[model samples]
Target: MSVPILKQGEILIASIQSALSDRELVELRDELADRVGRLRSRGVVIDVTALDVLDSFATRTIRGIAYTAKLRGAKTVVVGIQPEVAFAMVQLGLSLDGIATALDLEEGMLLLQRWPK
Candidate 1:
Protein backbone atom coordinates (compact mmCIF):
# COMPACT_ATOMS: atom_id res chain seq x y z
CA MET A 1 0.00 0.00 0.00
CA SER A 2 1.45 3.42 -0.98
CA VAL A 3 -0.13 4.93 2.07
CA PRO A 4 0.87 2.35 4.65
CA ILE A 5 -1.13 2.42 7.85
CA LEU A 6 0.29 1.01 11.06
CA LYS A 7 -1.82 -0.52 13.78
CA GLN A 8 -0.82 0.31 17.32
CA GLY A 9 -3.42 -0.96 19.67
CA GLU A 10 -6.26 1.54 19.18
CA ILE A 11 -4.19 4.12 17.37
CA LEU A 12 -3.30 4.30 13.69
CA ILE A 13 0.19 5.50 12.79
CA ALA A 14 1.04 6.97 9.40
CA SER A 15 4.05 8.89 8.11
CA ILE A 16 2.69 10.64 5.07
CA GLN A 17 4.71 12.25 2.29
CA SER A 18 2.49 11.62 -0.66
CA ALA A 19 2.76 14.21 -3.40
CA LEU A 20 -0.59 13.42 -4.91
CA SER A 21 -2.80 15.35 -7.26
CA ASP A 22 -5.68 17.23 -5.66
CA ARG A 23 -8.10 14.71 -7.08
CA GLU A 24 -6.02 11.86 -5.72
CA LEU A 25 -6.02 13.39 -2.26
CA VAL A 26 -9.77 13.65 -2.36
CA GLU A 27 -9.93 9.98 -3.23
CA LEU A 28 -7.47 9.16 -0.47
CA ARG A 29 -9.57 11.05 2.01
CA ASP A 30 -12.57 8.99 1.02
CA GLU A 31 -10.60 5.81 1.55
CA LEU A 32 -9.34 7.05 4.90
CA ALA A 33 -12.88 7.69 6.01
CA ASP A 34 -13.69 4.05 5.35
CA ARG A 35 -10.56 2.84 7.09
CA VAL A 36 -11.29 4.75 10.27
CA GLY A 37 -14.85 3.58 10.52
CA ARG A 38 -15.96 1.42 13.48
CA LEU A 39 -13.24 2.70 15.78
CA ARG A 40 -14.29 3.70 19.26
CA SER A 41 -11.60 6.34 19.61
CA ARG A 42 -8.61 7.16 17.44
CA GLY A 43 -6.09 9.81 16.39
CA VAL A 44 -3.41 10.38 13.76
CA VAL A 45 0.09 11.66 14.44
CA ILE A 46 1.57 12.76 11.12
CA ASP A 47 5.30 13.17 11.01
CA VAL A 48 6.00 15.80 8.39
CA THR A 49 9.57 16.03 9.59
CA ALA A 50 10.94 15.21 6.18
CA LEU A 51 9.04 17.81 4.15
CA ASP A 52 11.31 20.82 4.03
CA VAL A 53 8.87 23.33 2.63
CA LEU A 54 5.13 23.78 2.40
CA ASP A 55 3.44 25.79 -0.33
CA SER A 56 -0.12 27.03 -0.49
CA PHE A 57 -1.40 23.90 -2.20
CA ALA A 58 0.21 21.63 0.39
CA THR A 59 -1.06 23.78 3.20
CA ARG A 60 -4.59 23.64 1.82
CA THR A 61 -4.30 19.91 1.52
CA ILE A 62 -3.30 19.65 5.15
CA ARG A 63 -6.23 21.76 6.21
CA GLY A 64 -8.53 19.51 4.23
CA ILE A 65 -6.75 16.56 5.77
CA ALA A 66 -7.50 17.75 9.28
CA TYR A 67 -11.11 18.15 8.32
CA THR A 68 -11.24 14.67 6.86
CA ALA A 69 -9.67 13.19 9.97
CA LYS A 70 -12.25 14.91 12.12
CA LEU A 71 -15.06 13.45 10.03
CA ARG A 72 -13.60 9.99 10.60
CA GLY A 73 -13.71 10.42 14.38
CA ALA A 74 -10.04 11.12 14.74
CA LYS A 75 -7.78 14.06 15.53
CA THR A 76 -4.59 15.02 13.72
CA VAL A 77 -1.30 16.07 15.32
CA VAL A 78 1.57 17.27 13.17
CA VAL A 79 5.21 17.17 14.15
CA GLY A 80 8.79 17.66 12.98
CA ILE A 81 8.77 21.12 11.46
CA GLN A 82 12.24 22.38 10.79
CA PRO A 83 13.01 25.82 12.15
CA GLU A 84 13.97 27.25 8.78
CA VAL A 85 10.79 26.01 7.22
CA ALA A 86 8.78 27.33 10.12
CA PHE A 87 10.32 30.74 9.54
CA ALA A 88 9.46 30.55 5.89
CA MET A 89 5.89 29.53 6.63
CA VAL A 90 5.60 32.32 9.12
CA GLN A 91 6.77 34.82 6.54
CA LEU A 92 4.33 33.34 4.05
CA GLY A 93 1.65 33.21 6.73
CA LEU A 94 1.34 29.52 6.05
CA SER A 95 1.72 28.55 9.66
CA LEU A 96 -0.94 26.02 10.57
CA ASP A 97 -2.82 28.29 12.94
CA GLY A 98 -5.52 26.02 14.34
CA ILE A 99 -3.80 22.70 13.78
CA ALA A 100 -1.72 21.20 16.57
CA THR A 101 2.05 20.98 16.30
CA ALA A 102 4.80 19.62 18.53
CA LEU A 103 8.53 19.66 19.04
CA ASP A 104 8.87 16.05 18.04
CA LEU A 105 6.92 12.92 17.22
CA GLU A 106 6.91 11.65 20.80
CA GLU A 107 5.38 14.83 22.13
CA GLY A 108 2.97 15.12 19.21
CA MET A 109 1.52 11.64 19.80
CA LEU A 110 1.29 12.29 23.51
CA LEU A 111 -0.70 15.45 22.82
CA LEU A 112 -2.93 13.75 20.27
CA GLN A 113 -3.70 10.80 22.56
CA ARG A 114 -4.50 13.20 25.34
CA TRP A 115 -6.65 15.50 23.18
CA PRO A 116 -9.86 16.72 24.77
CA LYS A 117 -13.11 15.16 23.72
Candidate 2:
Protein backbone atom coordinates (compact mmCIF):
# COMPACT_ATOMS: atom_id res chain seq x y z
CA MET A 1 0.00 0.00 0.00
CA SER A 2 1.04 3.57 -0.55
CA VAL A 3 2.41 5.43 2.46
CA PRO A 4 0.36 8.32 3.79
CA ILE A 5 2.05 11.69 3.53
CA LEU A 6 0.64 14.63 5.45
CA LYS A 7 1.41 18.30 5.31
CA GLN A 8 1.73 20.19 8.60
CA GLY A 9 2.50 23.84 8.10
CA GLU A 10 5.74 23.90 6.07
CA ILE A 11 6.67 20.34 6.92
CA LEU A 12 5.70 17.18 5.07
CA ILE A 13 5.26 14.09 7.23
CA ALA A 14 5.31 10.65 5.62
CA SER A 15 4.39 7.92 8.05
CA ILE A 16 4.90 4.32 7.02
CA GLN A 17 2.23 2.24 8.69
CA SER A 18 3.13 -1.14 7.18
CA ALA A 19 5.82 -3.12 5.44
CA LEU A 20 6.60 -2.01 1.92
CA SER A 21 8.37 -3.65 -0.95
CA ASP A 22 11.37 -2.12 -2.67
CA ARG A 23 9.17 -0.61 -5.35
CA GLU A 24 6.98 1.12 -2.81
CA LEU A 25 9.98 2.47 -1.00
CA VAL A 26 11.37 3.91 -4.19
CA GLU A 27 7.99 5.37 -5.05
CA LEU A 28 7.89 7.06 -1.66
CA ARG A 29 11.29 8.59 -2.23
CA ASP A 30 10.23 10.00 -5.58
CA GLU A 31 6.90 11.27 -4.31
CA LEU A 32 8.42 12.96 -1.26
CA ALA A 33 11.01 14.65 -3.43
CA ASP A 34 8.29 15.92 -5.75
CA ARG A 35 6.18 17.19 -2.87
CA VAL A 36 9.09 18.94 -1.21
CA GLY A 37 9.49 21.15 -4.23
CA ARG A 38 5.85 21.49 -5.17
CA LEU A 39 4.81 22.42 -1.65
CA ARG A 40 7.90 24.49 -0.93
CA SER A 41 8.26 22.71 2.36
CA ARG A 42 10.89 23.56 4.91
CA GLY A 43 11.25 20.04 6.30
CA VAL A 44 10.24 16.43 5.72
CA VAL A 45 9.69 13.90 8.51
CA ILE A 46 9.48 10.19 7.62
CA ASP A 47 8.05 8.07 10.44
CA VAL A 48 8.95 4.42 10.11
CA THR A 49 7.79 3.36 13.55
CA ALA A 50 5.70 0.50 12.25
CA LEU A 51 8.44 -1.07 10.16
CA ASP A 52 10.27 -3.88 11.88
CA VAL A 53 12.62 -4.75 9.08
CA LEU A 54 14.90 -2.40 7.19
CA ASP A 55 17.11 -3.92 4.54
CA SER A 56 19.91 -2.28 2.60
CA PHE A 57 17.62 -1.13 -0.17
CA ALA A 58 15.31 0.53 2.31
CA THR A 59 18.22 2.21 4.05
CA ARG A 60 19.59 3.51 0.76
CA THR A 61 16.22 4.79 -0.35
CA ILE A 62 15.75 6.73 2.88
CA ARG A 63 19.19 8.27 2.59
CA GLY A 64 18.39 9.23 -0.98
CA ILE A 65 15.22 10.93 0.18
CA ALA A 66 17.16 12.97 2.72
CA TYR A 67 19.67 14.06 0.10
CA THR A 68 16.99 14.95 -2.37
CA ALA A 69 15.15 17.01 0.21
CA LYS A 70 18.34 18.81 1.17
CA LEU A 71 18.97 19.75 -2.44
CA ARG A 72 15.48 21.20 -2.55
CA GLY A 73 16.31 23.41 0.47
CA ALA A 74 14.39 21.30 2.97
CA LYS A 75 15.71 19.23 5.84
CA THR A 76 14.69 15.60 6.34
CA VAL A 77 14.44 13.63 9.56
CA VAL A 78 13.89 9.85 9.69
CA VAL A 79 12.19 8.88 12.92
CA GLY A 80 10.86 5.75 14.62
CA ILE A 81 13.69 3.37 13.88
CA GLN A 82 13.20 0.62 16.40
CA PRO A 83 16.14 -0.72 18.36
CA GLU A 84 16.00 -4.09 16.67
CA VAL A 85 15.89 -2.56 13.25
CA ALA A 86 18.82 -0.33 14.06
CA PHE A 87 20.78 -3.32 15.28
CA ALA A 88 19.96 -5.24 12.14
CA MET A 89 21.01 -2.32 9.98
CA VAL A 90 24.30 -2.12 11.84
CA GLN A 91 24.88 -5.86 11.47
CA LEU A 92 24.30 -5.50 7.72
CA GLY A 93 26.64 -2.51 7.49
CA LEU A 94 23.82 -0.18 6.50
CA SER A 95 24.05 3.40 7.69
CA LEU A 96 22.05 6.61 7.41
CA ASP A 97 25.32 8.57 7.22
CA GLY A 98 24.59 12.30 7.00
CA ILE A 99 20.89 11.98 7.58
CA ALA A 100 19.37 13.08 10.87
CA THR A 101 17.25 10.64 12.84
CA ALA A 102 15.21 10.65 16.05
CA LEU A 103 13.63 8.19 18.45
CA ASP A 104 10.09 9.20 17.42
CA LEU A 105 7.95 11.52 15.36
CA GLU A 106 7.67 14.25 17.96
CA GLU A 107 11.41 14.47 18.36
CA GLY A 108 11.83 14.42 14.60
CA MET A 109 9.58 17.44 14.28
CA LEU A 110 11.55 19.27 16.91
CA LEU A 111 14.81 18.47 15.20
CA LEU A 112 13.48 19.84 11.94
CA GLN A 113 12.27 22.99 13.62
CA ARG A 114 15.70 23.59 15.17
CA TRP A 115 17.39 23.35 11.79
CA PRO A 116 18.71 26.62 10.41
CA LYS A 117 16.38 28.20 7.93
Candidate 3:
Protein backbone atom coordinates (compact mmCIF):
# COMPACT_ATOMS: atom_id res chain seq x y z
CA MET A 1 0.00 0.00 0.00
CA SER A 2 1.02 3.61 -0.54
CA VAL A 3 2.13 5.70 2.40
CA PRO A 4 0.67 9.06 3.32
CA ILE A 5 2.84 12.12 2.78
CA LEU A 6 1.80 15.34 4.43
CA LYS A 7 3.32 18.77 4.26
CA GLN A 8 3.87 20.88 7.34
CA GLY A 9 5.25 24.28 6.50
CA GLU A 10 8.43 23.74 4.51
CA ILE A 11 8.79 20.13 5.60
CA LEU A 12 7.20 16.99 4.18
CA ILE A 13 6.40 14.15 6.52
CA ALA A 14 5.94 10.59 5.27
CA SER A 15 4.72 8.07 7.78
CA ILE A 16 5.31 4.49 6.69
CA GLN A 17 2.56 2.68 8.51
CA SER A 18 2.98 -0.76 6.92
CA ALA A 19 5.28 -3.15 5.21
CA LEU A 20 5.94 -2.03 1.67
CA SER A 21 7.33 -4.05 -1.15
CA ASP A 22 10.44 -2.99 -2.98
CA ARG A 23 8.34 -1.65 -5.82
CA GLU A 24 6.25 0.38 -3.42
CA LEU A 25 9.37 1.91 -1.90
CA VAL A 26 10.54 2.89 -5.36
CA GLU A 27 7.22 4.51 -6.02
CA LEU A 28 7.46 6.35 -2.72
CA ARG A 29 10.90 7.66 -3.64
CA ASP A 30 9.59 9.01 -6.92
CA GLU A 31 6.51 10.51 -5.32
CA LEU A 32 8.56 12.23 -2.60
CA ALA A 33 10.97 13.61 -5.15
CA ASP A 34 8.13 15.02 -7.23
CA ARG A 35 6.40 16.51 -4.23
CA VAL A 36 9.61 18.08 -2.93
CA GLY A 37 10.17 19.82 -6.21
CA ARG A 38 6.57 20.87 -6.67
CA LEU A 39 6.16 22.14 -3.15
CA ARG A 40 9.65 23.63 -2.83
CA SER A 41 9.97 21.88 0.47
CA ARG A 42 13.25 22.24 2.33
CA GLY A 43 13.12 19.10 4.40
CA VAL A 44 11.57 15.63 4.69
CA VAL A 45 10.88 13.40 7.67
CA ILE A 46 10.25 9.70 7.17
CA ASP A 47 8.71 7.92 10.14
CA VAL A 48 9.35 4.20 10.25
CA THR A 49 8.37 3.40 13.80
CA ALA A 50 5.57 1.10 12.73
CA LEU A 51 7.85 -1.09 10.73
CA ASP A 52 8.95 -4.24 12.55
CA VAL A 53 11.61 -5.14 10.10
CA LEU A 54 13.91 -3.38 7.70
CA ASP A 55 15.70 -5.58 5.21
CA SER A 56 18.64 -4.74 3.00
CA PHE A 57 16.56 -3.62 0.08
CA ALA A 58 14.38 -1.41 2.22
CA THR A 59 17.42 0.12 3.90
CA ARG A 60 19.03 0.84 0.57
CA THR A 61 15.84 2.32 -0.77
CA ILE A 62 15.61 4.66 2.20
CA ARG A 63 19.20 5.77 1.75
CA GLY A 64 18.50 6.40 -1.89
CA ILE A 65 15.51 8.48 -0.98
CA ALA A 66 17.60 10.59 1.37
CA TYR A 67 20.31 11.11 -1.20
CA THR A 68 17.82 11.97 -3.91
CA ALA A 69 16.07 14.43 -1.67
CA LYS A 70 19.40 16.05 -0.81
CA LEU A 71 20.15 16.49 -4.49
CA ARG A 72 16.81 18.26 -4.79
CA GLY A 73 17.87 20.67 -2.00
CA ALA A 74 15.94 19.01 0.81
CA LYS A 75 17.41 17.49 3.91
CA THR A 76 15.98 14.09 4.97
CA VAL A 77 15.55 12.85 8.50
CA VAL A 78 14.53 9.28 9.35
CA VAL A 79 12.81 8.87 12.68
CA GLY A 80 10.97 6.42 14.91
CA ILE A 81 13.30 3.50 14.48
CA GLN A 82 12.57 0.83 17.04
CA PRO A 83 15.40 -0.61 19.13
CA GLU A 84 15.08 -4.06 17.65
CA VAL A 85 15.12 -2.65 14.15
CA ALA A 86 18.15 -0.59 14.99
CA PHE A 87 19.95 -3.64 16.38
CA ALA A 88 19.10 -5.69 13.35
CA MET A 89 20.31 -2.98 11.04
CA VAL A 90 23.55 -2.69 12.93
CA GLN A 91 24.07 -6.44 12.98
CA LEU A 92 23.50 -6.56 9.28
CA GLY A 93 25.94 -3.68 8.78
CA LEU A 94 23.18 -1.59 7.27
CA SER A 95 24.45 1.56 8.82
CA LEU A 96 22.42 4.30 7.20
CA ASP A 97 25.59 6.26 6.74
CA GLY A 98 25.23 9.98 6.08
CA ILE A 99 21.50 10.03 6.80
CA ALA A 100 20.24 11.98 9.76
CA THR A 101 18.04 10.18 12.30
CA ALA A 102 15.98 11.09 15.32
CA LEU A 103 14.41 9.22 18.20
CA ASP A 104 10.93 10.36 17.17
CA LEU A 105 9.04 12.53 14.76
CA GLU A 106 9.15 15.58 16.96
CA GLU A 107 12.91 15.49 17.15
CA GLY A 108 13.10 14.82 13.46
CA MET A 109 11.17 17.96 12.67
CA LEU A 110 13.33 19.93 15.02
CA LEU A 111 16.44 18.61 13.33
CA LEU A 112 15.17 19.61 9.93
CA GLN A 113 14.37 23.05 11.18
CA ARG A 114 17.76 23.52 12.78
CA TRP A 115 19.62 22.31 9.73
CA PRO A 116 21.39 25.05 7.84
CA LYS A 117 19.59 26.27 4.78
Candidate 2: misplaced stretches above 4 Å?
Answer: none
- Please give the distance, in angstroms, between residue 35's alpha carbon in candidate 2 and its true position after superposition: 0.6
lDDT (Cα, tens digit) per residue for candidate 3, span 29-57 = 99999999999999999999999999999
Off by over 4 Å in 3: none
Across residues 1-117, which tens digit of lDDT does each residue of candidate 1 receive? 445656565566556565456565556556556666755437766666767776777677777776778777888777787788788888888867778888887898788778776
- Residue 97, model 1: lDDT of 70
Report lDDT (CA) for all predictions.
Answer: 0.69, 0.94, 0.95
Segments of candidate 1 deviating more than 4 angstroms: 17-28, 38-41
Question: Where's the lowest-lDDT run of ten residues in candidate 1?
Answer: 1-10
Better of 1 and 2 by TM-score: 2
Predicted candidate 2 versus true structure: per-residue lDDT over 26-56, tens digit per residue: 9999999999999999999999999999998
**Deviation in angstroms for 63 in model 1?**
1.1
- Please tell me which model should have the higher lDDT, number 2 or number 3: 3
Candidate 2 is scored at a TM of 0.97
